[model samples]
Target: MKKYRITVNGKTYEVEVEEITAPAPAPKKETPSVSTIEAPKAKAEPAPTPAATPKKATPAGKLTINAPMPGTILSIKAKPGSAVKKGQVIMILEAMKMENEILAPQDGKILSIEVTEGSSVNTGDILAVME
Candidate 1:
């Protein structure tokens, strides 16, 4: 047994550990002849069909804001058809336990919000569109 002191989260504690030894290997049994064994036939499975995904129609020459990293949408600050200025915060995203502000790319009216609060998003997922 070994004694040691450990500190975690600003707390200290003393503990002891016992050393364990590996067990001896067991004796091997004789193998059966291959000629006496029978293999089962395998059945082929059909391929799965892909699910249909709804597409969002983006207007021409509009700016689309995408998520910077994988995260959950914490809250939305701007609404559709609302006017926003360049560098304005439009939404908040929670990623890695941190709250990140989603900002507007340029001055424009928000055409649509692609994601809602509490929605999980991946990197490059569309968040909103403006024009």
Candidate 2:
């Protein structure tokens, strides 16, 4: 056996380590006859619980345009008072180091611009409005 003392942060402690020997191996038991044992029957699994129905997301209004995901506004392609068609690119959002185009969802004149260039927005945040 060996003993040692250690000090840490003004506290001292003594530790002793004894030499270890390998343990003797255990003896193996004889296997039982397979015919003497009956096979176990499978248990039936419980039925899965039903999930809750999700509520529909109702937009505040048809004219409100919201961000689809969290990101920074890279550029605004159209400004207020500008006429736009459905599927037209309205702005660029930088998210996850990639540029994503924000599109005009319907044909209308932009009523207001809610976010400025280089501004950060989260999912469902209003970015623009049209009517």
Candidate 3:
């Protein structure tokens, strides 16, 4: 048996508890927890204003390629400083039980690769950048 004193939110409480912790009763095996909180439903916060969208880069400028759909990145076929051709396969993305080849949007050098193999990505996740 033990006694405990707790303070939270500028309030104090004294509690007495018995410590006869044997194998927890079957179908009620969860450890008992002590709290001074009142459970309540969560309230959603207001959405924030969206920032302005950046202009998409052209072949002469750095172009970022985002995931066309949500999926795991199976492989990144190119790295930074690698030359790529228009419509060249730059990455392989796996989504919905399919392995889809990602093609370069334009002829350019790979400027950056944003995701690694086996990493999960969502639609619009920046996958690579070319310039």
Winner by lDDT: 1
lDDT per residue for candidate 2 within 1-131, as digits (tens), equals 99999998999999999988989789769876665677899899998986643423434654888899999999999989999999999999999999999999999999888899999988878888888
Q: Put down candidate 3 lDDT per residue, 17-38, tens digits, no spaces.
A: 9977589756866889988988
Show where candidate 3 strays beyond 4 Å.
1-60
Query: What lDDT tens digits, residue by residue, belong to model 1 across residues 1-131?
Result: 99999999999999999988989788779876666667887788888886644556667898889899999999999999999999999999999999999999999999999999999998878899999
Instruction: Order the candidates by TM-score, highest first.
Output: 1, 3, 2
Give the Cα lDDT of each candidate: 0.92, 0.88, 0.87
Which ranges of candidate 1 are over 4 A from the true structure?
1-57
Candidate number achieving the greatest TM-score relative to the actual structure: 1
> 1 or 2, which is superior by lDDT?
1
- Between which residue pairs do clashes occur in model 3? none
Ranking by lDDT: 1, 2, 3
